[model samples]
Target: MRVGLYPGTFDPITIGHIDIIRRATALVDRLVIGVAINRDKGPMFSLEERVAMLEAEIAPLQQETGVEIVAHPFENLLIDCAHDVGAGLIIRGLRAVADFEYEYQMVGMNRALDSSVETVFLMADLKHQAIASKLVKEIARLGGDVSKFVTPAVCDALYKRLGR
Candidate 1:
């Protein structure tokens, strides 16, 4: 069915994520937004909260974006998650050289786990490349507005989390 998976911790989904989803939808029949579970890195929002935020953020663009947004807690190996969901392709967005370095290693690791599944890398739209969850959180944490880069869902969650 040409299902593609786009997985990340998504501590908070950003405009970059939405942009990737927008682009990935064009190349595959369906896109599964897999939310990875990080055991070591503590997140501001709970996994459930992050998923809810993602769902709300994507609601308005659900029809217009032409991508199905589904969040899976990738507790197991990511390849297994893809296999479980019948994803033959993995879509990732690259923002810069550093991102490529990290993602390249991940791509290799994913391939080692499942050679049948291919990782497809997409360059982030220039305007959205700098919009990262960590940066967004940092900005919000410091009381800096990130309205242009984050969706309303994320903004609300950020504000709530920051007690603003």
Candidate 2:
């Protein structure tokens, strides 16, 4: 089976992220949204909370496509996780040039590890091109609305965490 692995910190799993996963689902037999565990970054939501929020956001799409959203607490390496999941394609969402620079390097390293593995870059919708998890959290913390950028569950989680 051709499985596409969409991996990211998903600090909160924005709508933009969801759009990419949704589109990727149509292109692959299986889509696994891998939530990378970054200890240094210090997650806004606890790993459990983030996973729950992601599950809620992607549940509908999973129901539609037989896809699944699961959290893989990855602190070691991306290639290791990909190999563990038997992913042949790495799905990444590109919002702008900044993301390209980072993703390009990752693609090269991933390819080096497994020449058969390929990275599939998907462009974010123009509306969400600049949306990112950190920015969303910052805006929400300052009492700015980010409901348009993130899912309802994520919005609620942010507010609850911030005591808003």
Candidate 3:
């Protein structure tokens, strides 16, 4: 089976993220959405919350695409996580040239760590290209609506967390 890993902080999975997940699942038999728990970044959502949100958000697509999808909470080395999950490819979403520059270096490092695993980049859909988790949270914190950027469930979670 060709398994792919799409890893991200996903403090609150956005529309842009769902777009990437949809595209990635079509390319591989199994696509694992690896939620990275990086405390240094101070994510708005807890690891458990993020995983639950992702699982709920992707459930419909999983059924629609007939693609095996799972939420994995991971820490430590990303390459090691890919190896652990038996992933042959790592799926990444690129929104702009700046994203490619950072992802390019990370891809090189990941390749060095595990040459057997390949990396694939999928461009974000035009509508969601400007959406990002950080910006979404910022907008919500300031009482701005983020419904366009995220799902209704995520919007509720943001409100619950931000005490809106």
What lDDT would each prediction earn against the true structure?
0.85, 0.85, 0.94
Q: Once model 2 is optimally superposed onto the true structure by TM-score, how far is the C-alpha of residue 142 displaced, in angstroms?
A: 1.3
After superposition on all C-alphas, the RMSD of every candidate to the true structure, in Å, is 1.3, 1.2, 0.6
Candidate 2 lDDT by residue in tens digits, 1-164: 88778898999999999899889988788777788888789989887877888888888888877766555666557887888888888899999999999999998988888888888999999999989999998998899998899877788888888999
Candidate 1 residues lying further than 4 Å off, grouped into runs, are none
Worst 10 residues of 3 by lDDT: 76-85
Error of 1 at 162 (Å): 0.6
Per-residue CA lDDT of model 3 for 40-110, tens digit only, reads 99998889999999999999999999999999999979999998899999999999999999999999999
Tell me the TM-score of each prediction against the true structure.
0.94, 0.95, 0.98
130: Cα error in model 3, Å: 0.4
Using lDDT as the measure, the top candidate is 3
Among these predictions, the greatest TM-score belongs to 3
Looking at model 1, report the run of 10 residues with the lowest lDDT sum: 65-74
